[model samples]
Target: MILGFGMDVVEIARMARILAGPPARAERFLARVFTPAERAYCDARQDRAGRYAARFAAKEAAVKALGAPAGVRWSELEVIRAEGAPSLTLAGAAAAAGARLGVARVFLTITHDAGVAAAAVILEGAQR
Candidate 1:
């Protein structure tokens, strides 16, 4: 069964600008949105722009997968990489919301082309 689904697109320039702003804002934003592992991966990557784009797409895709509205904060859904693939780790209200939505696991894919990055998320639930 399908629990939920989400997809998102982002402009590389926008994310780059956000990252370039006050360091505190970026830190706070990243703390809320990304898991430790995810943060580590991004931090270790030499392609900062690619890392930013991936995270941005993941956040957008997560909101869609959860079937939530725009107000859903980026911090609610975190994207991590495992074995070179993207995965999801939900926290706080995001977890509860996922449960309410009957989502058991979330799968995510992120890609970048030219100057744009995009992501797609799939939520899997118990087969009914």
Candidate 2:
């Protein structure tokens, strides 16, 4: 069963500008909004802006699908890529929100093109 759904989009240029700002500011921004693993993943790519933008959008979409639960941190929603397949790993407040909502899993899809990144998330509830 579907518990909720959400979608979000981000501008690649905007993300690029933030990432290209002063070293300290950029690091602070990244550390505050993204996990170390997500930073590593995006930094390893040549198109870092696009990768970061997509992941950012994914996080936003996940939060929206989860009903914008209070006190949920950005790092709690992680976008992971293994063997070329992308997936989400929830932790901390994000996991708690899922449990509270009876969500068994969250499906995620992300794409980037034309200087924009987009993501969609679907919260699936456990069968009774």
Best by TM-score: 2
lDDT score for residue 1 of model 2: 94
Which parts of model 2 are misplaced by more than 4 Å?
none
Model 2 worst lDDT run, 10 consecutive residues: 81-90
The local distance difference test score of model 1 is 0.79
Q: Candidate 1, 123: how far from true, in Å? A: 0.9
Write down the RMSD of all candidates, one decimal each: 2.2, 0.8
Report lDDT per candidate: 0.79, 0.94
The weakest ten consecutive residues by lDDT in model 1 span 67-76
Candidate 2 TM-score versus the reference? 0.97
lDDT of 2: 0.94
Residue 49's lDDT in candidate 1: 70
Which residue pairs come into collision in candidate 2?
none
